[model samples]
Target: MSRRWLLCLALLPCAAQDVIQDWIREIEQSGGGQVLIARAGYDAEANEIRLAPGTTRPELFAEYLHQLAFVRELMAAQALTVSRQTPEEGPLHLILINTARIAGRRDVEEAVIGHELGHAWLRTLGYPAVAAGNSVANCLAIHATDAVQHILIRKELRRRGIDAETPWIATLNDALDQWKVRPLPAALTPCERIQTASQWVDVRLGLDEARWPRITGYEAQLKTRYPDIEQAVSGLAAYLAGQDVAEKEVNRRALLEAVRRLRALAPPTTPLKTNQ
Candidate 1:
């Protein structure tokens, strides 16, 4: 098959968001309706954090809210807030992104949002749990783990017969490679930068299976639901191991849409907004 064909094949999994949504709908349909997601409430006193017109994608917006809710739950578990401002205390904060500028599609954006939300959730869970020995080392472990998970997702795609030439997979790997060699800036907080670097290495080497049992548990859960995950990941892992570009610009436009979905959740803001 042509490289372009492989790219399309890879993205086919992401295109099945509708099927995933259907599964969610089925749960709701079956009265297994549990509201794990929390919505941000309106705050009259706070500034209305309006997003620009570029930030448009209702499904992604809804998904972002769901992710925020998930993170909020984690925060509640640790008795903290993801931001300094509570849902009711702050403005109607909306994440805005230049949908045109990012590198993937709407589904890609969805994946990115999910990952970013995971970070927010982690912060809410309280890093203090790991703050010992070397705080910088701990932070590095967390951030690096997140980045590694992103690459892992790309790997999963390949196992599903999705080609590496696809824009999302290609860019995902490119990002991972660039991150591996990039040096930490001296001005950055030691722990945070360390965590960021750790994440880069994690993406390059894979998540540390020995340290985090929770990670293993989640992986098992995802794989249980999606059996093809192993195949997808294995394929990409093999490609990355060999430095092979298996796919090429199959759906550049669609890929860009995916990135937009991500930005809607975690808009690249100034000063790199950390979990407040």
Candidate 2:
């Protein structure tokens, strides 16, 4: 291990550090390559991950490992880049966690990291990719694919005893409250519509309506607020709800259909503008 990784492990509590070390060892033994970690941020304007400022490197890496220790399956990833940016992304096995969003909250950290790691796990399982040429299309593709993936991620998190639903419920309720006070614009751009609708779908699919009965209320509110994307959202939800089997083929098919449904929501004339 490198000196930086050693420093990162040193900053963690003894138990967590040990667990991380064991995970790293297993990856190495399985020929998965050395586990690399960095404190970084994604420049959305530039569409790249770069070293971020504000937090010390050691502190950031330690916080990442602390949350990571809870999700052993994430060790399948050979590299983890923790960022202090909003809107996390996981391309292949390279997972990014938005520390800024978590803000030192343990439950939020675990849930978010677990969620991102679930994406990584799916990648290792050969999950289908959503292809697009431009930023707007790419954003739509991402959200659409995530609609299906969130279902499995939530199921896996529950199996592992992680409370993934609470954090998302809190976030959705907060966003709804804020939007009610300020009100959304009468019109929304395709990117904005897809992003907002995607968040709602994520929570809707991930939340256990049986346990959190109020999710139905939130769903109704979201549909009321964004009437335009309701068809796409509902279509994706229905398609994913039928994907009860967790087998690879079922998920692959669900993702393809989900992506197709979401992409259909955006007009073909959408400009190739970069995401803001």
Candidate 3:
């Protein structure tokens, strides 16, 4: 994809204005981003906090709220905000799906947000200032960012009310937690290794990728798997064309749109071509 494609951001629906301003203040005053993430809010026993119905893991309830609030802070930081225009220089922008279309589970929804936040946060740490489509840098940075996200989210859930032994979260945390201990799969291909690392979050949680859930786990998978227009005329056409993209309409439509933009930016020859 051309630099323009990387610069573009999608139009996200406006969250409630009051929510936006309040969270921005919290994030700004919290001193450090990590501090904001680490601080606990009202106790579960307090009337102010309530868990979502049909579940008790805290992810859908207070945990989700806490994460969302933090996400708002991240958004306000000027890094995580999603806009139609891209900056000449700043963090590599986050690619977020329409939140309303994605299923309404709080944890899953915010995790999607968190995944992008991971990228935004990474930018502060000196992750390459390339566009999101830079597969190699994006891949390595995403894995490391995801690992850090796991720690933050898991810790926040515990502070809200969940115990380490809780099945859903324990299993979820374990999935992300233990992967760090294992050897990262060797990258045999440009996007393959990144795709594998991106899958860690979803595979362990058993979230169905076929349905196009907005979970962050699908980030690299979708990017690598998402079709790019350069696939048709560029020298790397075969490489782009060969990707197994998602079939779900909501997800596929996005892939197609992004591809169209990237296609416009395609050079007379693609960089992905073999022996280029």
Candidate 4:
């Protein structure tokens, strides 16, 4: 049988590159086959990395020399977990880093990579896979699953001493500030409402609203803005909160329940806008 390799891509300074190379070595040493680091755009539809458009031949070759690097040792740590927990899943891979997502901030970039690595770790432990289906169903399932997974990922990140909540807090704060300047939309489609609710639930569950009082305020604002999906969103948050992430079966059950709850709020015949 042919061995499947894990791929990672990024553009970073020399210092960061050295750090990530060490991570690659650790993954390889832990019985994950040779680690290949490259740079490219992520294809969400296909769920893999590929050469983006307008790439020059020289750029492609030079990418190998750079060997994409993330901000800190977080990647190495998560790679070790995946390598040890389920070597049969194939080599540890970091997937692709869409720089735009992180806005070129190394700290946020580290958190994003760490978050993705957490998802990869969950997969190794037999967390339920999103069922294959049409784009609408698939998109809903992915969001629902993500809602549940974020809880678990936050836990893992906290254990590693990473402040997973700060980045999200900043994002929500920005959104809130913008809303204060300009009123939120008077109405949104069922699909849009549900998607926003799901994201709000992620932020709610991930942070302590008591500490960050703004989170509580944000919930109130969201409820006012999206009254239709508020019930479903709150119920989903409660259900996920009750789950015990220590067990794989509990995680699986939570994901399925989340999907069912979110699906109930989805428009019956309309296609969802899945892009975030």
TM-score of each: 0.30, 0.67, 0.29, 0.67
Deviating ranges (above 4 Å) for candidate 3:
1-24, 30-95, 98-101, 104-107, 114-133, 160-189, 198-276
Which 10-residue window of candidate 3 scores lowest in summed lDDT? Answer: 267-276
- How accurate locally is residue 273 in candidate 2, as Cα lDDT from 0 to 100? 26
- Tens-digit per-residue lDDT, 1-276, candidate 3: 422222121122233123323433343344313211111123336734332232222332233345543333332221232211225422223233333223333344334444344433333333222233233433333332332233334443344343322333334444455545763343334333333333343233333445334335434433344334113223222222343322233223323333333334322122221100
lDDT of each: 0.33, 0.55, 0.32, 0.56
Question: lDDT ranking from best to worst?
Answer: 4, 2, 1, 3
lDDT of 2 by residue, 234-270 (tens): 7777667777637767766776676566667665344
Best by TM-score: 2
Which is better, 2 or 4, measured by TM-score?
A: 2
User: Rank order by TM-score, top first?
Assistant: 2, 4, 1, 3
Badly placed stretches (over 4 Å) of model 1 are 1-16, 20-104, 113-187, 206-276
Provide the lowest-lDDT 10-residue window in model 1: 75-84
* Model 1 local distance difference test score: 0.33
Q: What's every prediction's RMSD, in angstroms?
A: 17.7, 9.0, 18.3, 9.3
The number of residue pairs in model 1 that clash at the backbone is 25
- Counted clashes in each candidate structure: 25, 0, 0, 0
Q: By the TM-score metric, which is better: model 1 or model 2?
A: 2
